[model samples]
Target: MAAAGPGQHPGNRARLIARFGPMAGPWHDALPTLVDGLARRWGLDVGEAGGGGTSRVYRCRRDGDHEGVAAAVWLKLTPDPVVATQEAEALSAWSATPSVVRLLDSDLRVGALLLAGVEPGTRVRESGWRTADVARLLADLRTAPRTRTPLLPPLGERITFMYDMAARRGTHDPEVLAHGRAAALGLAGTGPADGLVHGDLHPGNVLVGPGYRLVAIDPRPTFGDPDFDAVDWAIDGATDEVALRRRIAELAALVPGMSAARVLAWCRATAPLTTGAPAFLVTPAGLRG
Candidate 1:
C-alpha cells in the first residue's frame, strides 16, 4: 500500500501548517540529504520507506562488510525532537523483545533512526484484524516491564496535561473538556494498574503476517492501565453513534475490567485535543471504527 507524504492531503496539511507553521517545509527539504549521509556513515543503504504526518521513513540496508544479511533496515526521519526521542527511547527499552522493532542508532539533532525493519505485512487496518487479534497483541505488549524513569508520563497524566494545554491555548471545547476531566478523575480514583502502555494501540499501528502473528509499530510509550489503550480502537470513526458505542462495548469486553462508558468518554475527551496534531498522530478519518 502506498503512503502519502506529509502535507500531501490538503485538509490535513492545512491544519498542520496552521498549528506548527511553515518551518516544516525547510526541515523536510533537508531530510533526503541528511538521511543519505547518515546511511553512508553508518555503512547502510538508505532510500524512502514511507511517509506519514511529519516524518518520512527510509528503507536501509546493513553494511555489506557485516555478516550474513541482505534485507534493508528502516529509518524514520522527523523534525520534532520530543517525538523522535520518545520513539528511540521506547525502541531501545524494548529492543530485547524479538516481536518489537529493533533500533540500531538515533541522531537526536537531526531526528533520525537506524532501525531493523520487520518483513513487510498488511497493516492491521487492511489485514481484516478482529478484536481477538488486538487483545492478543495487547497481552504480548503488556509483558514488557514497566518503568517510571520519566521518559514519558502515564496516559492519565498525559490526558490531563493535554487538557491543560488545550484550555490555555483556548482550543478546547468546554463541555468535552469537562467530561474528559471528570472521566479522567474517575479513572484515577480507581487506581488502575500501571504498566508499559502503548499510548496509541489502534489497528493502523499493528502489523500481521504469516501464521497470523501480530507485531506493533510506532508506539507512543507511556505508563498506564492497559484499558487506556483500548479507547483508540473503539471510537476512531463511526457515523452512527450507536454503532460506535457497540464497537466500544466489544473492545471493552476484550479487555478485562474496562467499561464501555469509560472508554467512550476517553475517546471523546482525547479526540478533540488531537485536532491540530500531526497526521501520523491524528488520522484524517478521525479515529477509526
Candidate 2:
C-alpha cells in the first residue's frame, strides 16, 4: 500500500497527550532511550513510518545486510500495554497464514516486534484498490486455521458501555449505540464454520500488489464466524447516508449468508465504539481483552 504521508491523519504525540495527559518524568526520560536501545539490539536503522491516533509505526532496516536482505520491519509504539500485547499475539497467530505478514520476533514485556514486511503496494486508500482485491485478501485471511484462543468480549458489553456513556456524559448518541447493541447480540451467537478471523478487515488494512494480490497487515485475530468480520470495511469512509448504505450492501454481498441490513446495524453500532477513542471509554482490543 502507499506509505502514509507525513503530518496526515492524527499525530502520535498529540494522541498520547490527549489520552494520558502530559507525559510523566520517568516515561518521558525513558522512551527515546528505550527505542534507541531496541534499535541497536535488533540491528535496525530506524526512520519514520506513517501512523494514526493511537500508535506510531517506524520503518526499520537491519544493518550490514543489503537492502534486499535487510528486512523492512515496522515498530508500532503505544502507551497502552494491553493494546500492544493484543496486537503482538494477534499478529503471531495470523503469521501462520501464508498471505499474512510473519511475526519474526516479539517482546510482550516491551511491546516490540520484528515482522516480515510485504513489498510496497497500494493501500486501500490509494487509487489502485478494487473490490476484487479486497475480496481475495479477505478470502485468504479467512483460510487461516483456528485455535482455542480466548475470544474477545462480546459486542454487547461494548454497546452497553456506549449507551451508558451517552446517558452519563450527555455526549453519547442513543440511536447509534442502540443499533450497535442489537447487532452485537445478534452476532454473539454466530460465526464462520471454523477458522481464524482478521477482526479488523478494512481497505486501509489491505495491501494490494502486482495483479492485485492481497496481503493483510494490522490484524486483530479471533476465533469466530468469518462473516462477522466484514463490518469494518463496510463502514469505512462512509460520510453520507447513501454512500454508507451502498458500501454496507457491497460488503455484505461479499460474505454469503450475511445481509446488508445486519452488517449496517452492526457497523452503525460499533464504529463509534471502535474508533480512536480513549480506552477507558471503549474496548480497544476487541475479543482478545
Candidate 3:
C-alpha cells in the first residue's frame, strides 16, 4: 500500500478537469504534491487514486491500531475548503454510529480525510440488494444523531443549483424546472427536519461491510427532512413508471412523511434537470411530464 497520485488515469484527469472548468489544469498540477504531503504526514501508505468528482480518494493503510482493530483507511482530498470542512464535521458528528463509515483522521486545511475502511467493500448495487433493503438503510440512517455544526447547507440549495443549471443550459423545460424550484421551497418549509440526512444517499453510496450489514460512505451530510433522502431511490434513473410508483409507495411506507405526492414532486422538480433519465422527468415518449 504505497501512496500514488491522480496522474494514472488520463480519462479521469480529463473528467476532473472538465468538472472544475478553468481551474482544472492547476488543480491537476497540484494533486501530486498534495497527495504526497498528506501521505507522509499521516504515515499513510496510499494506493491507487480514485476519481470522486469533487474530491480525490485513495485506498490507504497506516501503521496504527484502533481499539484492537488494524488501521485501514480511505484517504480523500478536496480542493474546496467549504466541502472539506462540512464533510469532516458531518463524519465527526456521526462517529459513534456504525451505519456510516467513521472518520479516522482529518486535515481540513488541505481538505484531506482518513476514513475507516469497510471490509469486502462491495457496493450495494453490485451486491444485488433489493429496493426494500435500500429503504431500510435510509430508515436506519435517519436515526443517526444530528450535527451541531452550523455550516451544513439546506437541501433546498442543492435543488436550486440543479434547477438553475438546467435553466441556464436550456436543456430542460423551464416550466418543469420552475415547478421543482417551487416544490423544493415549499417542501423545505413543510418537511420534517428530524435527523441527519445523508444528502447524497443512493445505491452507489451504500456499501456492504463485514462489521455493519450495510454502511454509508462519502456523505454530503445535511440536517433536513428525512423524506428528501428517501425520495432519491424513486427518481434516480427511473425508466418505468410502474416500478417507480411501487418504489415510491414502498419508500413512503418505510420512512414516515415521505408521501407519494411529495416524492413525486421531487421527481418532477429535480428529474428533468438531472443528468440521467430521472424517473419522472420525461416519459418514454420523449415528452416532459
lDDT of 1 by residue, 138-241 (tens): 55665666666576666776667667767777664566556656656566546454667677667777777446766777877777666667765665555556
Give the TM-score ranking, best first.
Answer: 3, 1, 2
Q: Each candidate's TM vs. the true structure?
A: 0.71, 0.70, 0.83
Put down candidate 2 lDDT per residue, 139-243, tens digits, no spaces.
Answer: 666555555454443333434655565556544455545554555656645634345566666667776655557777776555556655666665555555576
TM-score of 3: 0.83
RMSD to the hidden true structure, all candidates: 6.6, 7.4, 3.4
After superposition, which runs of candidate 2 have C-alpha atoms over 4 Å from their true positions?
1-11, 17-29, 64-68, 151-172, 190-195, 235-289
Regions of model 3 farther than 4 Å from truth: 1-3, 6-14, 17-24, 64-70, 168-170, 235-242, 256-260, 274-280, 283-289
Our tally of clashes for model 1 stands at 4
Model 3: which ten-residue window has the lowest total lDDT? 279-288
Clashing pairs in 3: 180-269
Best by TM-score: 3
